[model samples]
Target: MSVYTEVGRDQLIAFLADYAVGELVHYQGISDGIENTNYFVTTDKGEFVLTLFEHHDFGELAYFLDVMTFFFEHGIPSAHPAADRQGRYLKKLCGRPAALVMRLDGRGVANVASLAQCEAIGDILGQMHIAGQQFQSRRHSQRGPEWRQETAQRLLPMMEADQAALLKNELAFQKGYADLDLPWGVTHSDLFRDNALFDGEELRGIIDFYYACDEYLLYDLAVAVNDWCVDESGTLALRHYQALMSGYLQHRQLTDAEQANWNLVLRAAALRFWLSRLQDKLFPREGEITQIKNPDAFLKILQQHRHQPFSVDELQ
Candidate 1:
C-alpha cells in the first residue's frame, strides 16, 4: 500500500464536515497497499478508514463497494462503507474519488501465519464464497484471462529468456481452461496474508475488496491456498495446506470437475500474481510508499506448480 494522495489537516477537516462522523481528532496516511491511498481516521464518534481510489473511477468502483456491502449485510466480517450526511458512500476528496469504511478491531497476521490462522482463513473464505453465491452483482475480473495474456505479451521483452519462455508456456497451458463449467461467483481474488485481519486467534475482518470479482469459486480457493499455504521457497507446506483445505471443505464440498482441475487452477493463480508483480516492477507508478514486490518469488511459485504434479487427491 502506498500513499498516492496526500491530504492536509485543513483539507481533511473540510472533507469530514460533509459526513456526520463528529469532529476529526486525528488522521494519518496509511502506507500499506499499492492500489489506493488510505488513511486511519479517528473522530469523536468512531474510528474509520479513508480510501482514495488511484486506479478506479467512481463508476467502476461501485461494484466492489456493493460486493463488500453485500457480505457485511449478510453478517460476514467485511467492513461496511460509511455513508455521508447525504447518504452517499462515495464522494470526491482532494480531486480523487474517496469513501470511508468502518475499521475493524484486528490486525493482519504478523510474519508467518499459524496453522489455526490458515484454517480460519479457509473457513472464512468458504463462508464468503457461500455468501457470494447469493449476491446478484456481477463484475468480471479486470485482471482475468485477456489481461493476463496481453500483459504477458507486453512484458516478455523485458524479461529474461527463461522467464519469457516460462510465461509463454504457462499462458498457453492456462488458456484452454478459461471456460470450464464451474461453480462461479464473486471471489476475493487477492486475499494475501496482509489482507486478512486477526484478533487473538479469530479472523475478525477481511479488507481490500477492490480485487473481488466474478470468478470460479475454486479459482478463488486456489488463490488463497497459493499464498497462505506456501513457504519462502514457494513450495506447498503440507500441514498448512491440509489445514486450509480442511477448513474450506467443512463448509462446501468440491465437485469432481473442481477437484480434477485443482492443480491447474493453482498454477493459474500463481501465474496471475507473477504477471501482476512483473507488471508492477516494470511499470510502477509514483507514490509515497508503494511497495514493489519481487516478481521472481511468484515465478518460482508458478514453476513449482507447473513442474510438480501435486495431486489434489494427495491433499488429505
Candidate 2:
C-alpha cells in the first residue's frame, strides 16, 4: 500500500479523539492514488476514509473539503467530509493536514468502461457542474496554462526532439485560448475512470475532489471523455462519445461558446494529462508505492485529438 507516512495505532487513536467517529477498529493504507496518503478506516461508529495531505497545505485543503461537502449536500453522490466534534472538516494528523470522509460503498472499474457507464459518468459530471454554480469560493486550476508552460520547460530538457516539439507546440496552441471566456465553474479537474466508484452498472460514488477547482465546464467534460470514452488506441470511440454527450446534454446544454470551442477544449484536456504524466514520469517523487502512469498514452491521445477534431453533430 502507499503508506508514505505511517500512522501508529496510538497516534490514530489520538486523532480520532477530535471526532465523534467512535473507536478506531482497523485501518489499511490505500495504494491506488499518488497524491495523498489514504487509509480505509473502520470505527465503532462507522466506516470512513482517512486522508493525510502530502503536498497541499491546510488552507488549500479546506477548499476541497468545502467543495465535497457542497456536492454532497446538493444531491451529488460524492463522499462527504466528516466534521470533527469542533465542527471542523480540516484537522492535523501526523503533523499533516488530515480529513475523514464517509467511505463510498463500491469498487473502481479499472477496465474499459461500457457505454452505459460512460453515459452515467457524463450525466453525473454535468450535474456536478450545474450544482457547483452555487459554490462561493473560487480556486483556479492548479494545472492551468501557467503550470503547463512551466512544466513543459522543465520536462523538455529530459525529452527527445519529437516529444519536446509536441509539448512546445501544444503549449503554444493552448495559449491562444487563454482568454476565450468559456463557461466557468467548479470543475473536477482530474475525473478519470478510477476516480469514480460503481456497483454493477450503477455509479455509487465519485471520489477524490482534491483536484477540484474553477475552470471551463466543457474542459471538465473533455477530461471525462478523454478517459472514459477513448479506446485502447487512444482514439475517441464514436458510440461511447455519443452516449456521453447524450447523457450530459440531458441535464445541461452546452453554451454556444462552449460548442464553438469544443474541439480546442478537448485538445486542452489531452494536453493537460499529457504534460502531467510526462512530468510525473520524468521527475517522480519518493513514495512508498508510486505508480508512474504511461506518459506516452496521453501523448498518443493528444495527437489523435489534434488530428481528428470532432463536431457537435458527430457526438449527437
Candidate 3:
C-alpha cells in the first residue's frame, strides 16, 4: 500500500467516471505497505481503496480479484472489489493495472494487546481457509521455499559470514519438510497483526490479499503465530499462542502431519519473513513512500524458533 505511482486529481476523476462508485470527493495515498500503490479514495457513494498494481500482470490481478469476491461471498470479512458498468473489476489507471475495493470499517491493530484479539484473528483465519477450499483458481505461493532459497542466496553476499551461515542453515532446515503431506488450501500467506482490522476485541476485516496463495493450512497458522503471538523481542508469547491455536482448532482441526510438523512450519514462517525483509531493505524499489521493515526483527524470531521449538500439545 505504498505510493509508487502518483495520480493527478483530474486523471483520477476521469478514471472514476468509468465506474459507478460515484463522483470522487478526494483521495489520499496509503503508505503502510511496500508492494503496490494504494490510495484511500472517497466518493459520493462511500470510501474505497484504489490500488495500482506494481508488479502483478492483468491475469494475476484478476485471480486476486476473484479470490476477494470468493471470500466475500463465503461470509469472510474482506474488501469487495468494485466493478465497472461493464462488470469488469480490472482496469487501466495511471497506466498501470488497477482495481477499486470497498474500504472496510475499523483500523488495523498495530500493537496487539490482548489474547482475545489473537483468538479472534485465529478463528477468522480458520474460517477463511475452510471457505477457500472451494475456490478453483490455484496460484502457488510467490514467497514459497524456492523464492526463499533464491532470495537468501542473493542476500548472502551482502551480509556478514554468520548471518549468511544462518540464512543457509535455515533454508536447509526448511527443505527437510518440503514434501510433508499436510492439509493444503488457499491461504492468506501474510496475515500479520497489521493486516487485520479490529473493532475492540472483535475482528472486523482482513485486508491485503496480494500474497494469498495455495499452501499448507498449517503454514498459514504458523505465519500468523510468528506475527500475532510474538512479543516485541520476537519471542513467542505462550498464552497468546495458545489462545490463537485454540480458536483455530474450533473451526478446523489440524491433520496429524500438521500437528507433528508445527514447530518446523513456525521456523519456516520465520525464515520467510526474515529473507523478505532483508531483500526489501537491501534492494528497495523506488516508491513515493517506501517502508523497509526491520529484517533483524524476523532474524530474532527465526533464532527463537530454531532454539526453542514447541508443539501443538504445548499450546493446548
Candidate 4:
C-alpha cells in the first residue's frame, strides 16, 4: 500500500462534470504502487483508473501515455489514456497533473505457481517486445552495467560487509558482459507478475508505465526470468523457466550469442533490483505504505546464479 491523499467526492464530481465525461459518482484511492497515487474512479459513463503524477517527469509520462495508447489501438491489452472536455490526455487537478484511464478488469498474480502461468507470462512478454520495436520515441534509462554501478553506490552505506563485497564482485562480472551486442527497444523496466493481470486464466492487461524507457530488449526478458523463474526458497524453478522460455521463443527467437549473454543479463537483473530495494531501505520515502521490495530476494538470486548456472537446456 502507498500514501493516498483523498480527493473529496465533490471535487471529483466537479472534475467529471467539467470534463463532461460524466458525473464522478464515486472514487477511492488505490494502494498498490510505490511511484504514484492511483484512484478507482467511477463516472456515469463507466469505471476508470485515475492516476496523479508524482515523482516521474510529466513530459516522459506523456510520451509513455502516447505509447500505451498506441499499443491499445493495436490490440495490446492496456489502459488507454482518457481525454478531458478539451480533448486533452492530461488534466490539472488540485495543483497536480492527473489523467484518467480505463481500469483493467483483473487481479494481480502475486504467486505464479503453475507452468501454464509461467508460459502465459512468457508469451505476453514476447508479444510486448515484438510490438515495442515499432515505438520510435527514445527515453534513456540505466539497465545493465550503469544501473548496477549507480545502485551499488547508493546502497554502499546501508549494506553490511558481505553484501558490499558481493556487490563489488557482481559489478566486475557484469562489466565483462557489458560489451555484448543486444537488441534495443522500449522496455517495461519492471514487469514483475504484479505489473500484469489475469482475467481468470488469460493474461488480461499490463499496467504501470512509470519505469518504461528505452533499453536492451533482452534485459526486460531477463528481468522476467529472474522474477518468474525463482521459487520461494531462492532455488531455480527449472520447469517453470522452461515453460516461459519456450513460450517466449515462439515469438522472438534468440541467437547463440544472445543465449550466451543470458547469464550476465540474469545476474545484472538480480543486482539491479537488489540495489534498488537497498536504496529504498536506506532512504525511506515519506509515504503511507513504503513498498521496499525485498532486495535480499535478488541477492539470493545472484548467489544462486553464481554456482547453479542457467542454460538453454535448463530453459527447455
lDDT-best of 3 and 4: 3
lDDT of each: 0.88, 0.87, 0.89, 0.77
Ranking by lDDT: 3, 1, 2, 4
Best by lDDT: 3
Colliding residue pairs in candidate 1: 1-32, 1-33, 1-34, 2-33
Model 4 lDDT vs. the true structure? 0.77
Please write out the lDDT profile of model 1 over residues 1-316, one tens digit for every residue: 5688899899999999999899999988877767889999999999999999988899888998898899998888888999998999999998999999999989987566789999999899889988888999888888888889999889999988987887788888888767888899999899988899998789899998999899999989999888888898988899999999889988999999998888888888888888888898899988876777888888888888987868788877
Give candidate 2's whole-model lDDT: 0.87
**What stretches of model 3 exceed 4 Å from their correct place?**
none
Q: What are the TM-scores, per candidate, against the unseen true structure? A: 0.97, 0.97, 0.98, 0.92
Please give the ranking of all candidate structures by TM-score, highest first, separated by commas. Answer: 3, 1, 2, 4
Q: Write the residue-wise lDDT of candidate 3 on 43-74 in tens digits.
A: 99999999999999999988888888999999
- In candidate 2, which residue ranges exceed 4 Å CA deviation? none
lDDT string, candidate 4, 1-316, tens digits: 2554456677777666656567767777776766677788887888888877776556767877887887787677877888776788887666567788888888788785568878988887788889988888888774456776876787777678987887888787887656678887888878888888887678888887767887777888888888888897667798988888888888999877777887787777777787777777787777544466776888888788887776765567
Native-referenced Cα lDDT, model 3: 0.89
Candidate 4: misplaced stretches above 4 Å? 4-6, 142-144, 176-178
Question: How far is 57's C-alpha from truth in model 3 (Å)?
Answer: 0.4
How much is 96 displaced in model 2, in angstroms? 0.6
